[model samples]
Target chain A: NAGVTQTPKFRVLKTGQSMTLLCAQDMNHEYMYWYRQDPGMGLRLIHYSVGEGTTAKGEVPDGYNVSRLKKQNFLLGLESAAPSQTSVYFCASSPRGGVGQPQHFGDGTRLSIL
Target chain B: GESVGLHLPTLSVQEGDNSIINCAYSNSASDYFIWYKQESGKGPQFIIDIRSNMDKRQGQRVTVLLNKTVKHLSLQIAATQPGDSAVYFCAENGASGGSNYKLTFGKGTLLTVNP
Candidate 1:
């Protein structure tokens, strides 16, 4: 089973460009999250959803928007991509809405804004 | 004596040797802790976990130890192999009386096993 799937494994964009990152899960998890990873830094939470039709801001939420229209899908949108936002993006899902639960992650999407 | 944080951000060991990676958390209320390993260009994979009550938990070749007194966590790999080389992360599970729980991760330590 595809535990977690992230679309556009790799992408490139120019400054001010917009893009969307899609995360899908087949485990029927109740919680989903979006995080960014940079060199020498731990994965920082960007946005998350407790359940379908809900979204919440994370530690790093600026310049990012998220939507959870369906239980199986969570989308992260970048309205205006910047060079600083060109880090690897990861999508994760967990059985519960708590951090104590083990989260399954996608391979990750490599994005670069020049 | 208590350690304020991780002593080493990188570790190297000869193949077949035991390796230990350390992590320190800042929260006292965190009850759940997890260890994750990430290889090059991949997602972080769960290795093991321990709760506040438990001091240790083992999974296959990996073991996780949590010392709540110091808010410290550690991962021990026995008979380290080349495949064990990767970045290791420790996460604390916490909730601020909210429905959504979030994991806070520390700066990962890079482990290298040399033959």
Candidate 2:
């Protein structure tokens, strides 16, 4: 089974352009998260969803919005792409949010904003 | 904001040797810690994890050690091989008297295993 998958493995955008990144998981996880990774920087959470129809802000939620319309899908949207938004985007899901649950991640989407 | 940081940015080891990566966290109330390995063009993969109550945890070829008094954590790889070369990250999860379960990851340490 495909654990987690992200669409648009790579994308290039210009300033003020808008786009959405899609994340899907075959595992029936209850929690999903969006994170960004830059060179020499660790993964930073942008947004997360605990369940279907529920969303919450994470450490770096600015310049991004998320929607969890379905239990297996989480979408991250950039209203207006900026140069600073260029980074590798990752989607992760976990069966639960607790001490023992480890997050499973997708390959990642390399997004560059020019 | 609490932060997780690595002691060294890079490390090199020879095949058949042991490798150790260090990490330091600022949050004392953190209840859980995890170690992840990320290869080029891939996402981070979970290696091992330890809870605050436990000081050590071991996996197949990896071991995680936690020192709560110093807020320090370490990952040790046994019999390092070329395939073991990658970036390692340490993450912390804090419980602020609620159902908080957010992860704060460290910068990461690049491990190079030479044959």
In candidate 1, what are the lDDT values of residues A34-86, reduced to their tens digit? 99998867789999998999999999999999999999999999999999998
Q: Candidate 1, which segments miss by more than 4 Å at Cα? A: B1-8
Q: Write the per-residue lDDT of candidate 2 for residues A36-61, one digit (tens) a residue.
A: 99876778999999999999999899
Stretches of candidate 2 above 4 Å error?
B1-3, B6-8
- TM-score value, chain A, candidate 1: 0.97
lDDT for each residue of candidate 2 in B1-115, tens digit (9 for 90 to 100): 1236433388899999999898889889889888888999998888898999999988998999999998889999999999999988888877766555678889888899999
TM-score of each: 0.94, 0.95
Please report, as a residue range, the 10-residue window in candidate 2 chain B with the lowest summed lDDT: B1-10
Candidate 1 residue B92 Cα shift, in angstroms, is: 0.4
Per-candidate chain B TM: 0.90, 0.92
lDDT, candidate 1, at A65 = 99
